[model samples]
Target chain A: MAVREGLLALLHEGPRHGYQLKTEFEAATGGVWPLNVGQVYTTLDRLERDGLVGVSDNEGQKVYSITVDGVSALGAWWEAAPVDEPPPRDELMLKVLMAIERSTERGDAHAMSVITHQRTVLHSMLQSKRRARSVATTSLAARLVTDALVVRAEADLRWLDLCEAQLNGTPTRKARS
Target chain B: MNDPVLELVDVVKTFGKGSTEVRALNGVDLAVSPAEFVAVMGPSGCGKSTLLHLAGGLEDVSSGRVRVAGRDIGDLDLASRAALRRTDVGYVFQRLNLLPSLTALENVALPLKLEGVGRREASARSLDALAAVGVTEQLSRYPDDFSGGQQQRIAIARAIVVERALILADEPSGALDTMTGDSVIELLSSLPGRFGTAIVLVTHEPRFASWADRVVFMRDGVVVDQTASTVPVSAAGAAT
Candidate 1:
């Protein structure tokens, strides 16, 4: 979520204090763009540093009003990039890989245990993803991200099954390593 | 009791072209009464979720009739069907899909507001829904702040808050620990009578499936068994 430019645009609506800005942003965007208090301050400081917003101190409280440049930046960001698509990183995969190392030193039992747990978790996740897909009433980018997650989760599950088979000393791939 | 809230007759869903195709659902038949709770169980790829989707109007069936509140879903135009879904169906998924930014109350209220209810009224009804699910204290908190059980409660609140006739939940309690899942199941099983909403839940856990007033088992896209047990069926009965 782009916080700075979006926050700046809200300031352009009127000169407002940080807390009020956060509250108004939440209400204005229908609770979609939630602003944490700390993040609101940090973004405001950066905006002032960049000369995109002018800060006025009144009664020991700082009020921020959007500068012309801030308005332009907000417009630019809105036009250029309304959504962010980050790459997928599987934290579970990392944990599973670590377990595989432990199993190599320990015993097949540990590896089998890991695989079993992952199977249960993946099955749950897949069902959840299917439900989410069914009721998705949101942006295209969000739906795409969900689709990617589901496919990746399913692939990890298939790979886990293969690992489980190998760990069990099944007669596949000629022989176990 | 005479007119079912939802009815699926010999539903079939297929994916891909002839030779390389897969039959996701095969000749499934089911019905849910007003305010009834039904759980669907099947192995992965057995079409339990497919049945839920057909009932919710998320996907169309290859063949068979899907009716919600006496209107055939297949007979409606795309826009009309979408409207029906927005107003008549509320869905809960295994993963809590609550928008992170929205407060619990707002997340619950989004559906009402989307359908053109005023903000104050939407918020008020959302608060009532949150209260019903026992999440009233967490009203202003975002989804990330709460535990999994609480989030699922909020999701449930969202599903039935609009007084939708049907709520389709796909593995609503699948993500949590056993204790939390049980709490969620209790919360879900209670809503039908409280809100007068029919529900179809897809789940793999027998304990979770047991929460339903009825259970329908599917295999290879067909409903193999259907039975109704009064509320609070024995654990052994659930396992079977």
Candidate 2:
């Protein structure tokens, strides 16, 4: 979805062929999100089909440009916050849910064990990220990414603690393992 | 292994007596080596503070032994315990406990002064301790004049000024904002490597506790779990 809108935003700057859009997108995001030429062309084809982009030929290459409607769409995209839409399918959450169901059916303690294992793994990851954050030589982009990961991992650990508390019928407190 | 700077063997601590008895700690065993940072984590009323108090010689154990620097605290007289506290153990509280009337340098120097160190030598050591925590410029400022982070750093400097082997911190970062709290935790975590100070910290926040070399979890007056931290304590040749 970001790539789709990102291509539009790139074309809005100036008319660019497929290859140019791919290169510019990667460059703009500090190479964090690499784009493939085929994917770019496919997205451009869809945008043109929807009348959000116009195609022109220059020097035997097709140049894509954002249409008036595309500009309005980009404006709306900029103004509106990104919605989760389908509410991202987090694999860890799915796995934990399945583990809980299976543990209950088998009368086992596998669910808590699974949570504990994941928390240890996440805790180790959090420690490394924290170390990276503390290093003065780390880049701002790397630092920001680590910070986000740390926050997410902390939140996930808290959720796992909450799940354990609920399963054991213990009162939930603000501070947790 | 070399003797741990702090050790508790089957330690039990109780409050009141008879029918109103409350066991704050029951059969707790812990050992912390010099330069090792250990975090004690648990829910409220779970004996975390009691364990810290016992280790710091602030409270008497009802049974078993509490040792610091290879000496059993229970065998020490009141004056000997006080002298040991002055020279071998430091406590950092959640409130910092800085004297409002004293400057940062003076507050940090107070411990050494109480130990009967000369004024000049104590002040010089206090300045070095303050500089170690990056608070060199705030030496003359009173606790009220410094930011929460600065005040905590000064408190840390005070804790380490006597060059104590064991530093007991009870929620040292509890009163600061998350960022400041994290920096404070980072400072405390670094001390084990920088000064060979064994730290036993009690905190409910796992985020802060992650800074330790090991974490001990308590529940119902006993240690329920223990885990080693992933972050390796710098290889300073200190024994585990």
Candidate 3:
């Protein structure tokens, strides 16, 4: 979340252009979080405006480097960074709830299709995460996030199971609704 | 030490009396070695579950001998049989029957906690067991949070964590998809050789049966066929 501080920490090592900073940030964070060119420029402008970084023309590009105050701010934030709490609602669950409602009116075919679509999406996401794991520098936070995603995928499969059983007219655990 | 993990000699389990009687197991004879992975496979109503229950000492034999872990279950009193189940055998049913409120880790730790292990120690052991089965990440999640394969693994983790001499599972992977079910079977089949815990699994699926180190097919309350896998038999006694 503190994109500026983390990028500033890297700049503290030496002056770096925006492109160089993006590459370093991707390396440090396991490449799971990709920084777009626009996002990087936006953050750079904010940092320069806040006096945490100073930019000067070097060669053909504007090279930005961290100020002394930026170094202390990055250190303090790193030491006391709070863990992100789990959000109260999940979008996938909302989708499933709507699918279940549609199943009653449109027949279980609708529900089965919805689940099949979700399964495909989740599987592709899982493959991407796995691929990232190999090329990316692994970090503790990245591992935890990947684990949470895996668990959510598993839960979706379980829901797919109940839906399949329902479509086949086989008995399953009663729906919550 | 050639003591069989389980042996049933001319065991007949009959329910009801006279003309209304039912013979669940009819003069059955079988032997299972220590730390072996054995699968009991048959069609519905073929007495597979009954055979497992009899072997694990959950039910009494009516006409002959039943021995488990070198102890004649026929000779053990009620109290001792209960103790044997508590300390020597772990049972998993098709339903899972995990407590709803307990997290996956807590569900796995119940048996150890019941055996007098302290809370922290039990949880530590449970976590290790979950990790062994590759379900450690879901340890804090409840059963409802898992896939069918994950839940089955957690059930298995609970069964083998306490180092039970024997583990009995009925349709452990029946609820999972083919790929996930196969993975679970691999996990169960590998567990015994790693921990020296003999396992007797019941399943109607032939694919599930093939994972066992040995297959003992039952029909009409008798062991109709038996075959060993790559591993050597335990060379244990079969006399009950």
The candidate that wins on lDDT is 2
lDDT value, residue B96 of candidate 2: 49
Candidate 3 wrongly placed segments (more than 4 Å): A1-177, B236-240
DockQ score for model 1? 0.01
Residue A24, candidate 2: C-alpha displacement in angstroms: 7.1
After superposing candidate 2, which stretches have Cα over 4 Å from the reference? A6-71, A79-81, A84-118, A164-177, B230-240
Model 2, A50-131: lDDT tens digits are 9999999998999899999999999999988886454232677987899888877776778767876666666666666666
Tens-digit lDDT string for candidate 3 (B97-120): 577799999999998888889999
Model 2, position B120, has a per-residue lDDT of 95
- Which one wins by DockQ: 2 or 3? 2
lDDT of each: 0.77, 0.82, 0.75
**What order do you get sorting by lDDT, best first?**
2, 1, 3
Better of 2 and 3 by lDDT: 2
Give residue A141's error in model 1 in angstroms. 51
TM-score-wise, the better of 2 and 3 is 2
i-RMSD of all predictions: 10.2, 2.4, 14.2
Tens digit per residue, CA lDDT, model 3, A1-177: 778887888998999999999988887775677999889989999998888899999888999989878888788888995766543335766776687778776555566556556644554454344335434566866766665665565566556545655654533223421
lDDT of 2 by residue, B1-240 (tens): 456788888889999999999999998888787788888876678899989888878899999899898899999999999989988998888884799999989999999899899999999999999999999785787999998888889999999998889999999889999999999999999998899898999997778877777777776688766665443443212222
> Could you tally the backbone clashes for each prediction?
1, 0, 0
For candidate 1, lDDT tens digit of each residue in B184-224?
A: 98788787768878788898775565567776666568765
